[model samples]
Target: MFNLFKDESQSVNSFFLFMQSLANRNLVAEALKVSEAKYRSLLENMGLGVIYLSNAGTVISANQVAGQIMGLPLNNMVGRALTETCSRIVKEDGSVLAHEQHPAMLALRTGKPVENVVMGLFNHAQQDHTWVMSSSVPEFLPGEREPHQVFMTLTDITRRKRVEEESSLASVIVNNTGEGIVVTDQDNKIISVNPAFTILTGFSRQEVLGKRAHCFQSPKNAIKIDEALRNSRKNGNSWQGEIWHRRKNSDDFPCWTTINQVKDATGRTTHHVYVVMDITHLKKDQNRLGFLAYHDPLTKLPNRMLLKDRINHALQNARREGSQVAVLFLDLDRFKIINDTYGHAVGDGLLKEVATRIKNLVRKEDTVSRYAGDEFIVFMEDVSDTKSPATLARKLIETFNIPVEVKGHTLQVTTSVGISLFPRDGDDSDSLIKNADAAMYRAKKEGRNNFQYYRPELTTQAFEKMAVETELRQSIDKRELVLYYQPRVCLKTGNIAGIETLVHWQHPVMGLIPPARFIPVAQESGFILALGEWMVEAACRQMRCWLDERVPVNKIVVNVSAFQLLRSDFLATVERILREHELSPHCLELEINESSLMDNAEHIIKALNGLADAGMDLTIADFGKGYFSLINLKRIPAKKLKIDRSFVSEMLCNSNYEAVIRSVIALGNSLNLQVIAQGIESEAQKDKLIEMGCNLGKGDFYFPPALPDAKNLTKLMS
Candidate 1:
């Protein structure tokens, strides 16, 4: 309390000391000279105008850069209100330039720094010119009543802005193109992908960008694409071609694409662009047209033209390789009798079953074609010797010894085969086919099912088959193709398993069209793959639905043909159907004849193993009918054995057949095989097979072949 006066004196002393310190600042002649020199030097060097405005909004100072930006002299811009010194213009988003809001004015009013705020200045004629990205800074003096100055800096970035805008437009165009477009930088990292690429391939730009272009390749097309890309890069040019690619869904599709490499002036590659167009559908249509031109649509087999081509090619190859090839001409025994009695529908069924058997017996490397209405030609290439051809002929005769079931009837069938060997039987395709055909007639004359080799005198008889193949091609739309199903039964329980699908054809105007009628036609026409796929998908849907209902269902057996089996997408197609219908692999069994397995053993075995691992079962439909060795039979890990029906039908009557059936059963049992006796019509036959320890019997003795939705299926359970 007593020191208050002393404290007031000290405060007064401190204030004078501060004043004296500010007075030492030298804001006089020396300061003026230093500031003027610095200001002039800065103005001359800057490309933009710099301005300083007074607190009252009059220009106090101006630099050469600022004068240039406003298109006015330094003296003219000075002593003028910043707003009046420039003709103000509205900005693009529609904001007006006002004096108080201007950078210099704002700096003066608030005593704070402002940068890159746009303003307008008056030119010589009082017209305003706008300058963008200008800045203002406040200049202050010690002990002053108001801010002494505002300094401004101006720059024109319009050229840079325009370049940026053009670059943005180009980027938009690249991103929106319809063709699948990919851009890679010099380092080969993907820089961009167009919208169409994302849509077609199911990969977003974010997902693929920065990844190398080579990542999209599958092993099937990797080598070709790599070579093409490498070549294109080396030449610094463009290349175009068709390529195979797999989509994100794991489906392989065809694409026509172009690749271009971009290079710099130094001749170094800097970027690459890829344009792709999908061509899967186009290829499919081309294949369809080609198939139609040379194949029979009805049976989906190679017709006479295709057969002749194959035979001619085989002959040429045989001559070049010094190898022997044989042609076996087959004619169905008693095929007309079945057609006359059971109607053409049943006749078609018989023909289809015959085709199935014939397909089963031949090697995959061999070609079996429908020669005519009821005759077939089997071309065996790379035969080890003349004995090989004869052995195959005997196997064909044995194959027909099986019975075909149609409309609840067990019909026994046989085939007459005529054999002709390459280099031994006149060498050329026409002569060999002629000799084989002649030999088949001799077999028919000798007692129908037996075969005879051509002996020069039977040329007229051989010529008869050529006429039949020509007629079969046009017979399908003429109502010549047929459909049939053979009943399969559960081996352990003797319950109806499922039907094994088959097809046949007969011409109304031409009586019975054997498998020789339409199968060769379909195969030649390339319709077989389509037809087989249709059959499998249809059968799968029906049987899978019935099985879903838990109606005492056993696995439905579908046949996979050699053509269908060899397709690249075959597995994917099967998987798609099963997934679509919610069907389990356990509900279906695939019957691949022995011939197909032997022809592509490694791939087929791998495919079968994959299917099996996924829970689908496998069966050999016509056992003891194919050209596989006994060791091959043991090597194939099949789940069931279907005893050919011919043996079951004649077991009681033919002693030789009885012994064969016994041996088959014993061999099957020794291999832990489940044997299903097909064509068990009479009670006597069923008892005989049951006594022989056959696991199950199908045919008239049980229930007739029925649809999966049959109402009376439960009645035959026992």
Candidate 2:
């Protein structure tokens, strides 16, 4: 029994030993799995590409990065021969490299490691050769002479190589070009210059470095170039023009130059490039043009420069003899209208004709010159008084009154002469010309086609005119102009026949300014065009309101200037305005000054006929005033003839004006036109007009001019 128990105990001990050995084997298997997993993770997460290949130069295993570097999938790289990834090895110049020269194959055959061998490999995925700088090392087992595998890494170098090639090409171009080229840093310091610059400027690269490009420019040219540079900054980043440059030998020459500025990514200037072309040989006529500077190129009359010289000479002679020098500044009245209506070619022809006429009108001793556009200055020496200037002025006006024929157009150009005497108006040429110009403006204000002598007060008026003009321009832009309406009553029915529009400037500080104070200035300064257009538009717009309210009004009359009527497109503008407001053309009436009807009779008649044909009413205004011949009344196409306000106001007191009024009333009746009298401020005058067979009248006695306030316009009209 003792021997059996001992055998059983031995059997239990052997079973426990067998279980311990099996547990130890399982732990060893788990450790191996964990180590291999960590190694694979390291290879996948590393930014660098890692690959292991067999000694045959074939892809064995590769990470994602390695496959991406070769522009292929990792699975494709793993099982494929290297022919799929790289077709053949190539040199840096893209020439075929010998198979023996390949680093991977060499290390395998020579039993030596190779490092850093640049190569061009064809990429199957990219379908192009990829330039890569590669370093390869042979891996060998211990005590083995031959390498079993190659450890290779790749870096792309295509972009860098292309940059080097471009730089080389640009260097060759800069050296061989004929035009001089210069580059400057942001500080305007010279940084680089082409060899052509040295050849043209006689300076080497070392001399001009770190210096301003303008340092070697001529003094006169430097000022001009500096100003141009400032303008270029304002306008754009480039400038092209001609400038004088001084070479190292101090020899000056003209050069046509183009400058281009370069800016960085952050909108800051980085550098500037200058291209220069020497133009010294091309300006052969420069000296010839100098001799013709004193004469006007268009009119061939003495220009402003020569006018000044003649004025000085006349003053010198007058001072010695104690005589007066008459400087008549003659301006063509409304010449701009001619230029605008006809083409400039016709206008130029008219100007030459006027210049010839004035030259013929003056004495041989007088210097008649074209002062500026449509202006002529005549400085007559040995003048006794203002009579000489006045006589010449009258003749000039009379001569221009006759129609000038140019380019199939008969233009009646008129003159407004301003006389300024030396030692009276001014002692110098500049002051004399300036004072004459001021007086010329006065003549235009007093109604053009007349002469005026310069007085000290004209200067004050000139300054005030300038102030008014500046403020008036602002008023137009800001829409500060307001409209006023006055009624023209029918004498037969004692009802409102027409409403005339009057413009007022509602000045911020000066209250309301009437048309009388600023109309003349507006007329002279071409602001009348804007004012006239505004008045017509405002009238048509008010008529639209009246229509909305169903007010009892016949027509709204707008006093249109000759300037507006003579516009080539005035008829179209009126038609457009009426169409916009949906108002009938007959609701608007244009009242033009009688003198303007005769001034440009041909053109005015044409424009009026167009308006009349369009179903608009036309009225000849300020009748029997100014130099109006009764013959034009027959051709005027007017529905109404308004008696001159001045003549009507003076009628009861003056017989001559009453006679003139009666004749005008008779003339209207004979021509089948309505006769309207303006400025009837008394019941007596109104009754007298009725007795004289006048149809309509307008004055304070009927209704003083007030704004057509939309809120109460219907009430006021009723």
Write down the TM-score of every candidate: 0.36, 0.58
- Alpha-carbon lDDT of model 1: 0.73
**C-alpha lDDT score of every prediction, in listed order:** 0.73, 0.83
Residue pairs clashing, model 2: none
RMSD of 1: 21.1
Error of 1 at 582 (Å): 1.7
What stretches of model 2 exceed 4 Å from their correct place? 1-281, 288-295, 305-326, 358-369, 379-403, 442-451, 478-480, 508-510, 626-632, 653-655, 710-716
TM-score of model 2 (CA atoms): 0.58
Clashes of 2: 0
After superposing candidate 1, which stretches have Cα over 4 Å from the reference?
1-486, 490-493, 504-517, 548-550, 706-718
